[model samples]
Target: MAEGFLRHLAGDRFDVASAGTDPVGLNPGAVEAMKEVGVDIARQESKKVDRFLGQRFDYVITVCDRAKEACPTFPWAQSLLHWSFDDPAAAEGRAEERRAVFRRVRDEIAQRIRRFMARERKANKDPAQ
Candidate 1:
């Protein structure tokens, strides 16, 4: 979802990537939630963090509780932010209930992206970052 937001909100500014320590494939519920918001992530595939280990990123954002810990330390990253969003895929009970959780997480992620974008814009405006 962060990738979706980054691409939609500020793709021109930063390249975005999303990965996990243990990938369980893209959740259909998450795809559905993002679809409602007009972000199509169906083509995005699940990938392990190892694929990005050697690469450098300016910022690394982890959305899950375990990922913050499982993610490797990026000495090259200027910043690392962790957000403990409940795993929508882990949501139990009915299908509607699961989708609700996904939507909640997706919305929360969108809000965070907006906040980050605002901060980045402010920093870019300043002579000193």
Candidate 2:
């Protein structure tokens, strides 16, 4: 969801990709939640962090506590950040209840992405930052 929001909000200004320590494939609830807000993430794959180990990135961010602990270090990245969000996919309940959790997390991720973008923009404007 973070990847979807970042891609949607940043457009071509940033290149974004997301992977997990344990790749469980994309969740249907996530796809539905993103679609509610006009972002289509159905095409995004559930990748393993290993796939990106050889690549360099400007920022390496982890969106969950478990991933933050298990994720390998990207020492070359300019910024390494963690945004601890609940794993909505882990939410247990009926269909609508699970969808509600997805929606809540989706909104939280969107808000965080907007804040991150604002800070990035400000930093770009101020060389000292």
Against the true structure, whose TM-score is highest?
2
The whole-model lDDT of each prediction reads: 0.85, 0.92
- CA shift at 58, candidate 1, in angstroms? 0.9
lDDT of 2 by residue, 22-85 (tens): 9999999999999999999999999999999868899999999999999999987888999999
- Candidate 2 has what TM-score? 0.94
Q: Kindly report which residue stretches of model 1 are placed more than 4 angstroms away from their true locations once superposed.
A: 126-129
In terms of lDDT, model 1 sits at 0.85
Candidate 1 on 17-115: residue-level lDDT in tens? Answer: 888898888888888899999999988978988888868788989988878877888877888888788888889989898889999999999998999
Clash tally, candidates in order:
0, 0
Instruction: Tell me the lDDT of model 1 at 35.
Output: 93
Instruction: Provide the TM-score for each candidate, comma-separated.
Output: 0.92, 0.94
How far in Å is the alpha carbon of 15 misplaced in model 1? 0.7
